[model samples]
Target: MPFSNKVPTIYDPRIGSPMLDAEEANFEEIALKSLGGFVLVLNDNGEIYYASENVEGYLGFHQSDILHQPIFDLIHSEDRDDIRQQLDINFHIPTSSPSNQFDIFAPPNSKYLERNVNARFRCLLDNTCGFLRIDMRGKLMSLHGLPSSYVMGRSSTGPVLGMICVCT
Candidate 1:
């Protein structure tokens, strides 16, 4: 089905177990898109499995262009160590632990612009886009009993199955 901003209702079809009912799901999808945001579903190894279409609106790169790429490839090299540190923290958190949030900021410095994987980052569109400073807030979740898409993963592995990464 085409992605929509409307909330999902009871009648909406979800491939596996549903996280939100039809209406709520639709509403969230819509809200995220309306806010010029998109979602990414990544495995423990930091490989992106899914990239919502709205990513083009936010990053200027099409979803197709970034699919299957390691998320770190898009990050500034100077910031990679920090990202790794954060990912390590996420993986160490047990399933029973409370939800945690992390903030990663990339300034529009030469270091950041020099590492842009896509040329689009060279164009300063706005504060939110291009090499201007991008702030990412990610929630690291434990996938003990979620959908197979999250558990079995695109490539089956212990760490990949145990982690759920949602980035906006």
Candidate 2:
């Protein structure tokens, strides 16, 4: 995959699984092209797995700059510990529940250009891959929706996927 200034990194796809199906990849492309939306996938450990072509619209970052970075690095510190606790506890108990309503403010001097953003986080992998997707700029969170999160991860079959939480 190519990299850009908005995202400083990218990684090889997971070794075992087959590449995403054509229909799935096409669906992602449609999403990215429509609604001007972007997509991102983090591993159980929070490393960047894949990002949609339009990721910059939401993160003020490009997929190239995002690879290998812990998802928590993008989160606001004030909310990290509490969100972490929830993700960890949720893992042990096995619930993919939504969090209480809240917002994660854009960081000062942050990479993202648009201001007044927010997102609705989803625990996508509780049953299989075990990761999170911060849904951005949809009718989901608000007009300026942007999703981001941290995944410390857990073990599933073999991967050391941990825990994670989204700030807004």
Candidate 3:
């Protein structure tokens, strides 16, 4: 038998590449077609620092347009307090060692309602874009080497990275 050489890697048919360059990966232009949805990164300050290219399909705002904007801006006002409380609680919970896996808590009746949390919110696009509800799913972890403000949590040393999925 002839020897064959191929390195296996994580694959995404939508992106056509296992690993996207920093710029390409951050771009959410193709997020609309992805069943898995797009990725988002929020700093501990609750500001959006990174949004995949596809974010526009969900929120009608481009990634660049929303950068540095508070995540609360996208949330419906009625839900802000509840979501803020949940975020505070999440920020205080200590990470388990050995695994260091963080949790992403969503509001009641959310798409991934595995646990019971009182937080609930609707994600709306711009005023002119109309009403649209977006479901967010992601994890929280310490991300080093980011801007100082991103890591502004009371207890955590480094900036908290929220890797999330924006889904309709």
Cα lDDT of all candidates, in order?
0.49, 0.39, 0.52
Off by over 4 Å in 1: 1-29, 34-36, 89-130, 143-168
Q: Report the alpha-carbon TM-score of model 2 versus the true structure.
A: 0.37
List where candidate 2 sits over 4 angstroms from the true fold.
1-28, 82-159, 162-168
In candidate 3, position 139 carries an lDDT of 48
What's the TM-score of every candidate structure?
0.49, 0.37, 0.52
> What are the per-residue Cα lDDT tens digits for candidate 2 across 136-163?
3211111111133322232333223322
Candidate 3 lDDT tens digits, 49-101: 77777767556677798888887787767756654554443444445522245
Candidate 1's error at 97, in angstroms?
13
Order of candidate numbers by lDDT, starting with the best: 3, 1, 2
lDDT of 1: 0.49
How would you encode candidate 1's per-residue C-alpha lDDT over 44-131 as one tens digit per residue?
A: 5666667777777666778898887877777655665655554443334346645343221224221211111121122223655444
Please count the clashing residue pairs in each candidate, in the order shown: 11, 24, 7
Q: Against the true structure, whose TM-score is highest?
A: 3
* lDDT agreement of model 3 with the native: 0.52
Error of 3 at 137 (Å): 1.4
